[model samples]
Target: MIRAFRNEDSEAVVALWLEASLQAHAFVGKGYWESKVEDMRTLYLPLSEIVVDADEATGEITGFAALVEDFLAALFVAPRHQGKGTGTRLLKLAQKMRGTLELSVYAENERAVEFYRKHGFKVVGQGVEEATGHLELTMRFGG
Candidate 1:
């Protein structure tokens, strides 16, 4: 089920992000991801509106999506839960709640680009992220 973020869920959510990020962005060094754990916990997450996907039976969080205003700031599904629709479900929930969503994704992350396109987001612009120095595409849904 999809639900609102809880302060209590922070630990599980951060751990999920680390695991999923390490899996999805294997091109990036483990140390890079590890270094961001603190910022993800204290800085980014606190600034976004977060929602989590919880297993109905175990009540464990399997994935989460974060939104800032109408833009999707982040989404991560546990590696064990990949290809199980957890990320898509969380994104659909975001669409229902916000009606429109926008995001920027790494140009090299083909899987994520395909996923967003499959969900009706279209690339509107491209740029480089100063933080990672990675090429990125800006995509938007619902105009």
Candidate 2:
């Protein structure tokens, strides 16, 4: 079940983000992701339009996608729930909500970059992310 994010879901969503980030972004130090938890909870999540995927039977959040304007600020799935189409479902919802979407992904995260490419997103630009000095690719879809 896909639905809008609620304030009460913050903890679960943040945890999911951390877990997914650690798994997908192994190049980034763990401390960096940990340090951003508060910001994700209070700043980024609040500033974006977020949608979560809840288990139909258990109602536990399995994945989520956050969009700020046309940019996909975040998309994460619980590790245990990944490879089960949860991420794809969340992305489809984001696309339906915003016809044209843009997102920045770390160039080193090949799995994620390929996922976006498989979903019809194209790398429109690339640059270094000043915060981490990591090469980041800007991808776009339907635009």
Best by lDDT: 2
TM-score of 2: 0.98
How well is each residue in 23-126 modelled by candidate 1, as lDDT tens digits? 88877778989999999999999999999999999999999999999999999999999999999999999988899899998888899999999999999999
Alpha carbon lDDT at 8, candidate 1? 97
- Per-candidate TM-scores read 0.96, 0.98
Instruction: Give the clashing residue pairs of candidate 2, or none.
Output: none
lDDT of 2 by residue, 104-135 (tens): 99999998999999999999999999988899
lDDT of 2 at 72: 98
The per-residue C-alpha lDDT of model 2 at residue 56 equals: 89
For residue 60, give model 1's deviation from the true position in Å.
Answer: 1.2
